[model samples]
Target: MAAPSSQIDQLADRIERLLVRYEELQRTNALLQQQVDSLTQERESLKSRLSAARARVDALLERLPTLKNAA
Candidate 1:
């Protein structure tokens, strides 16, 4: 049979390692969440700019004379 003291020490070491891993994962998750938020904001800004550009192009096309009208 294994000694009680040695078994207790082994269990304690495993718990400490697990705690360290858990903390590292939490930090990694927080960093990923921040990245997601930044990208989402950038995507929204780009979409708004694209819409404005399309509107400007449409206005310019309307001002141009059509071939049928010119003839």
Candidate 2:
């Protein structure tokens, strides 16, 4: 009977510990998710800027053809 009681108490303690660890993991996961969202937004902003720059470069290249004809 004593052995059984001890085993039950140990199991209870393990369950409590596992619950606490799970909570900690949940908080960490939430933080990581927020960071990923922020990074994705930043990536999109950079992509937009890059696209604008490429367009400007293409416009400049197109002008070069006209300039060459005038020369």
Among residues 3 or more apart in sequence or in different chains, the pairs in candidate 2 whose N, CA or C atoms overlap within 3 Å are none
Clashes of 2: 0
Candidate 1, residues 1-71: lDDT per residue as tens digits? 88999999999999999999999999999999999999999999999999999999999999999999999
> Can you write out model 2's per-residue Cα lDDT over 1-71, one digit (the tens) per residue?
56998999999999999999999999999999999999999999999999999999999988776765888
RMSD of each: 1.2, 2.3
Which structure among the candidates has the greatest TM-score? 1
Model 1, residue 12: what's the lDDT?
Answer: 99
The TM-score values for the models, in the order shown, are 0.88, 0.85
Clashes of 1: 0
Worst 10-residue lDDT window for candidate 1 reads: 1-10
User: Candidate 2: what lDDT?
Assistant: 0.96
- State the displacement of the C-alpha of residue 41, model 1, in Å, after optimal TM-score superposition: 0.3
Q: Which lDDT values do the candidates have, in the order given? A: 0.99, 0.96
